[model samples]
Every structure is written in C-alpha cells, then in structure tokens.
Target: MAVIPVAIAGAPYEVRIKAGILAQAGRHCRPFVRKNRVAVVTDEHVAAKWRATVEASLAGEGIASQWLVLPAGEATKSWAHLAQTVDFLLGQEVERKDNVIALGGGVIGDLTGFAASMVKRGCGFIQMPTTLLAQVDSSVGGKTAINTPMGKNLVGAFHQPSLVLADPLALDTLPLRDTRAGYAEVVKYGLIDDAEFFEWCEANGEKLLAGDAQAREYAIARSVAAKARIVAQDEKETTGVRALLNLGHTFGHALEAETGFSDRLLHGEGVALGMVLAARFSARQGLMHGQDAERVVRHIGAVGLPASLRALGLDCDGRRLADHMLHDKKMDAGTLPFLLMRGIGQTFLAKDVDLGEVAAFLDEELAA
Candidate 1:
C-alpha cells in the first residue's frame, strides 16, 4: 500500500492506494465516518460491479449503507442530477459533520463532492475513485464540479474529500479504451515538469496499461504526490503555481465543448489530443523545438489516443471551436490564458494569446 498525503493546510488528507483496498473500505474509512449509517453515491455501471463488496465491507464494521446509484456518463454531471443527489442525501438525513462516500469514477466523485459541499452549508465526503483518471487526477485535487450548458466544470466548489481509497483491482474491470484515456492524465504529470518521469512513462506506459500492478501503484502515488504538493501551495489557484496543473486542460476543455462533451471524444481523449496540439502549437510559435513536439505526438499516437485534430472529422470551422473557449472558466479580461510548452517539462501560461490567431492555427491543424 502506498499512502500519499495531500497537505492542504486546513484539510489535510491521505490518498491510500493498494490492491483490494475496496474490499477493506470500511476499515479504512472508519475514522472519517461518524454514524452507524453511511450514504454512498455511485453510478449504475459501477454499482453492478463492486457494490456488493463495498456493502459487505461496511456491514462488517457494523455500518449500514444507503445507496444512490445514478445513470452513468458526462451528462449526469448537471444541475438536474446535482439536485437529485442532494435530495437523496437529504433523504438519508446526512449531517454536515458526517461523511458520505463517493464510490465511482470522476463523475461520481465530482457530483457527490459538489452535493456534499452544498448539503447543510457543507459536509465531508470520502472518495473511492474506481477509474485511473479519477484515482490519479480528479480524486486528489479538491476540484469538484459539474458540466453546464456553457462549459465543462463551470458550476462547482472546492470541496475536499476526507479520504481517498484507490484500489488497483478496480482497473481490472475497466475497458482498455477507458484505461488508455485515463493514462493521458498520468502522462500529463510528466509533461508538466517531470521530464525524467516522462522518460519513465515512455519506457513503462505500455506495461502500466497492460495491467502491471507495480506500475499502476507507482504512477498513481507519484501523480498524487505531485498534485498534493501543488494543491498545498495554491489551494484556490490564486497563484500561477497551481496553473501548471492545467497544462493540457485549457485546450482539452475547448475540444470537449466542440464535441458537445459526448462519448464521441472522452475527456482524456480530448486531453491527449489537446496536449499534442499544445506541443505542436508551441513549436509553431518557436516556443518549443519541432522535434520535441513530434515526440509528444508520437507517444500519444503510440498509446492509441487521438493525436490529430484533423482526424476527428469535425464539420465546424476553427473560429467556431475558438468560440467555445470564450465560455471557458479561465477567460479573463477578454483574453484566454493558454498553456504552451517550451519543452516536454516546460509549460507556462501565456495570457497574450489572440483567439483569431488560435483560430488560424486550428485552421492549419484542421487542414494538415
């Protein structure tokens, strides 16, 4: 078991990673859960797989679990489901002092955490992220949100989980395509500032995707530690230090909006292509070497992620895609800050980006 500490000053917590941790969920979550009855929020797909095991574990600890299993997908992260989840928790008589469990992937964690944040002013929640994307990225950072018609993650709050239990055994049930998509975030840490880790990924990413237990644990622990250090420094993203974490997200979110935030392009798939675009765009502006940009594209393509915007076959023009970014949460003073790379490990936020120029670049990418 690898325990990574998220050192947020007032709400420090631990992300415990291990194989079969979900089977021992009750034992691990005993301290944070206060009452005999606990409310667990999950999705229909996840409930069918691990729900019984989790229920049995909690029962062994003399706790009764009330469950709210929602329909699965990005669409579930909406105002409608938020109200539903909040109502369910209220129906269960959850208190601000009590902890509820978020027992699925990113969708469950985001929705449940946001619901917990609003119930009775605020309440604590536990994160049992069952996906690689959630385990490595979304589950660790205290950024809980739901997608709005305007954009992804536009309406939400910073509600930290009391504890995060990531079980590698969960991935054994995940589809290979979903696992590969989640692996994109794992590669993001390397692209953010850890070139050596990027090299490690170049060598071991295939093995990690192939279900190597040691590799999965190491990658999750390392990614969590990196995020913990950043979150501790800039909890609210007021400082630019935390912005590094959004290296591929700005562009990725735009792509998601373009695709209507549907299964046509998974969040991680959008991010994978976004990182490629960021790199290639960096190279186009001479901020990074062309060879370095191609390297990023090579790794992303090798991993079977979408590395080319042209291949998406979108009928919209570049201007329309850039328009989607106008609704981005990071838009400030009529300018959107872009994450561009100087190299694999060198990402910086550039605020002087012109959307027209970005449209032109996208046009070029779309044409290429």
Candidate 2:
C-alpha cells in the first residue's frame, strides 16, 4: 500500500493506494466513522461492480450502509441531483457527525462531496474512486462541484474528504476510453512541474495503461504527490498558483459545453485536445518551439487520446471558442488569464493578454 499525504492549509489528508484497499475500507475509516450509520454514495455503474466489497467492509465495522446510486455522467453533478442526494442523506438520518463516502468516478466523487458539504452545513467525505481519472487527479483535490447551464463546476464548494482510498483494483473495470482520458491528467503533473516524471510517463505509459500493478501504483502515488503540493500552496485558488492546475480545463470545459457535456466528448479527452491546442498556441506565439507542441500531441495520440483541434468536432472556430472562454468561471475583471508554456515542464498564466489577439490567433489556426 502506498500512503500519500496531502498537506493542505485546512486539513492534512492522505490518499491510500493498494490492490485490495476497498475491502479494507472499514479499517482505514475506523477513525472518522464513529456514527453507526454511513452512506455509500456511488453511481449505478460502480455500484454494480464494487458494492459487495464496500458494503461488507462497512458492515464489518458495525456501520449500517445505505447505497445511494446516482446516474453516471457529468450531467448528474448538478444542483437538482445534489438536492436529491442531500434528501437521501437526510432520509437516511445521516447526521453531520456521520460520514458520506463517494464510491465511483469523478462524477460521483464531485456530486457526493458537494452534497456532503452542504447537508447540515457539513459532513465527512471519503473518496473510493473507481476510475483511473479519479485515482490520478480528481480524488485528491478538494474542488467539488456540479455543472451549471452557463458552465461547468459553477456551483460547488471546497470540501476536502477526510480520507481518500484509491484502490487500483477498482480501475480494472474502467473502459479503455475513460482509462486513457485519466492519463491526460497524469501527464499534466509532469508538464506543469517535473520533466523527469513526464519522460517517465512517455516511457512507461503503455505498461501502466496495460494494467501493470507497479506502474499503476507508482503513477497514482506520484500524481497524488504533485497535486498535494499544489493544493497545499493555494487551496482556494485565489493565488495564481492553483489556476495553473487548470492548464487545459478552460478550453476543455468550453468544448465540453459545446458538446453538451456527454459521452460525445469525455472531460479528459477534451483536456487532452485542449492541452494540444494550448501548446501549439504557445509555440505560435514564439514562447515555445513547435517540436514541443508535437511532442505533447504525439504522446497523447499514442495513448489513444485526442491529439488535434479538429478531433473535438466543435462547430465553432477558435474565435468562438475564445468567446466561450469569456464565460469561464475563472475570468475576473473581464480579463481571462491563460496558462501558457515556455518549454517542457514549464507553464505559467499570463493575464496581460488581449482577447482580440487571441481571437485572431484562433481564427488563423481554424483557417489553417
């Protein structure tokens, strides 16, 4: 088992990664789950797979388990769904002292954590992420939210889970597409801070994707460590530091909006394509070389992730995408800052940029 500690300002947490950790959840959760009743918040998909193990564990700890299954998709992470989840918790007599455990992918984690954060003003949240995406990225950070019609993650709170239990065994059930999408974030940790890690990913991503045990554990631990450091520095995203974490999300979320945020465009795939565009745009501005852009695109494509602007199939051009970015929740004072790169393992947000130039550049890229 790999125990990764997340030293954040509000709370110091840990992510436990192991092969059979799901079966040992009760032992791990013994401290926080004092109340007799615990809600296992999961989606239909995950509930189908790991319900037996989770329920058995909680039951062994003398905690009654209530399985609250939501629909499995980004659309379910909304105010209405969240309201329903809170209602379930209330109906189950889930007191604030008791804990709510999220047992699925990012969608389930985000929705359950948000509900747990709101109901009775606060409750405990434990992440039992089942997907590669959740294990590597979303499960660590406290950023929990549901999408609004205007944009993604518009309504949410910073609610950190008391514990994060990442069972790599759970990811075995993930679809190939979802697994590849999750890798995009794993690669991002390298791009944003560590060149050595990035190269390691380039060398071993194939084995990791093939479900090699050591590869999975190493990638999850390293990715968690990278995110832990970032969150510790800037928990609320007020400083420019946390925003770097959204390296491709600004463009990626807009693309998701255009696609109705469905299976038509998975979140991580959009991010993969978005990162490619960001790198090419940076190269175009002479901040980085074209080869760097190609390197990112090549590796991502090699992993079966989206590698080009055209692949997303959004009807709009770059100017239109830029316009959509204007609605991004990250915007402040009518100026949108972008995380642009100077080279590999290097990216920084530039706020002093003109939208017209960005729009023109997008138009040129679209025309090209």
Candidate 3:
C-alpha cells in the first residue's frame, strides 16, 4: 500500500492506492476514524461485490459501520438521492466525530461528500475510490457535489476528505467500457502537465489498459502528484493554474448537459471527445500543429474511448451545442474560458474567445 500526500492548505489528506486494500479498509482508515459509527456510502452495484469484506474490516476495528447503498448511475447525484442518504445517516445516529465513507465511484463520492458537508454542519469522511476514474481524478480533488437542474456538479462544495483509500483491485471487476472511459482522465493528467507522461502514455497506454498492476499504480500516483502540485499552488481553482485541470471539461460538460447528464455519454467519454475537440480547435486557431491534434485523437481513439462528438450519434447541431456552452460554470461575462493547448502538456485558458466562431466551427464539424 502506498499513501500519497495531498497537501492542500486547510485541507490536507492522503490518497492511499494499492491492490486488495479493501479487505483492510478499517486498518487503512484508523487515523481519521475517531467516533464509533461509520457510514459507508456505496451503490448497490459495488456493495454486492465488496461490502462483506469492508464491513468485516470495520468490525475488526471495533467501529460499527452501516452501509448506505443507492442505485448505480449519475442520476444518484441529485437532491432526492442526497436527502435519502442524509436521512439514512441521521437514522443511523451519526455524530460529528463519526465519519461517512465514500465507498464506490465518483457518484457515491460526490453525494457522500456533500452529505458529510451538511450533516451536523460537517462531519469526518473518508474516500474509498473503486473506479480508475475515481482513483486518479475525482476522488483526489476536493471538488465534491450533487447534480442540480441548473447543471452538473452545480450543487457542490470543496469538502475535503480525511483520507482517500483507493483499492486498484476493484478495477478488475469494472466493465470494460467503464474501464476504457476512465482512461480519458488519465490522459488528461498528461495533457495538462508532464508532456513526458503524455508521451509515456501514448507508448504504454495499451499495457496500462491490459490490466497491468504496476501500470495502474504508476498512473494513479503520477496523476495524483501532478494534481497535488497544482492544488498546492491554488486550492479552490481561484488561480488559473488549477483551471487548467479542466482541459477538456468545458465542452465535455456541455455534451453531458445536452444528454441530460445521463450514461448515454459518460463523463469520461465526453471528456475524451472534448479533449479531441479542444485539440482540434487549438489547431484551427493556430495555437497547435494540426498533426498534434490528430496524434491526440489517434491515441484516445485506439483505446476505444470516444475521441469525437460524432461517435455519440446524437441528433444535435452546432448552434445547439454552442448554446450548451453558455451554461458551463466557467463562462464569465458571456465568454467561455476554454482550455486550449499549444501541444501536449501545454494547455492555457482562453478567455475573450468568440462563441460565434465556436458555433461556426461546430457547424462545420457536425456537417463533416
């Protein structure tokens, strides 16, 4: 087991990553858990596979743990679902010192983190990330939220966890589509920083996807390291350095909102397609070489991730897509601050961009 330190001012925690760490969750979580009760927030899908082991581990620590399992999907990240989780935790007689454990993917993490932020005004919480996407990206960042009608992750807070336990062994049971989908975020770490890592991914991505344990650990640690550095510089994303983390997320969120934030276009899939679009748009603006964009597309495409919006087969036009961008949280004064790249490992936010030009580009891309 490896514990990587995430040192954010006023929000320092560690992200522990290893295979088969699930069986020792309580031992791994001993430091943060002080109160007697622990709420293990999970989904029905993950509970069936690992709940017994997790429960036993907590029982061994003499800490009583109750499981709160919601249905599996992005829809679970909503007010209705969150209210239910809070009710369940309150019924479990939770206290401020007692902790809520996020024991599944990003949805569970976000909802549970939000609940922890509210229950008794605040409570201790731990993250047990099971998916590749959760391990490397969402679970590490302090960004946690539930979805609202206004937009995805609109109702969230930067509620930092006491500790994050990521068991890579859990990824073995994830469906292949979800596995490949996660690769998109892993690729983002490379795109935003560490051009060497991006090139390494292009070369060894197949090995990483082939279920190599070492490869998985390296990806998680390196991605966390990069994010930790960025967060150290700017925790709340107030500084533009952290905004670079949204490399493909602006267009990606638009795609997600257009799909009603459903599983039709998974977050990572939209991000994959969004990264492709950002790269191509960078080339169109003379910020990057066209071949560099193609290289990004080809690498993501080879992994079976969605590298183009066209592949989603949605019945939408460019004007509508550009309209979706208007709702993105990053928009300010009607200008969408897009993360454009000069090349791999060289992304900067572009404000003062013309949405009319964006609409025209989308129209042309949609027609093609």
TM-score of each: 0.99, 0.97, 0.97
For model 1, how does the per-residue alpha-carbon lDDT over 123-160 read when each residue is reduced to its tens digit?
Answer: 99999999999999999879999999899999999999
Q: Which stretches of candidate 1 lie over 4 Å from their true place?
A: none
TM-score result, candidate 2:
0.97
lDDT of 2 by residue, 109-185 (tens): 99998998888899888999998889988988798999988888888899898999999898788888889999899
Span of ten consecutive residues with least summed lDDT in model 2: 309-318
Q: Once superposed on the true structure, which residue ranges of model 2 sit more than 4 Å away at CA?
A: none
Candidate 2 colliding pairs: none
| Candidate 3 CA-lDDT value | 0.86
RMSD of candidate 3 to true structure, Å: 1.2
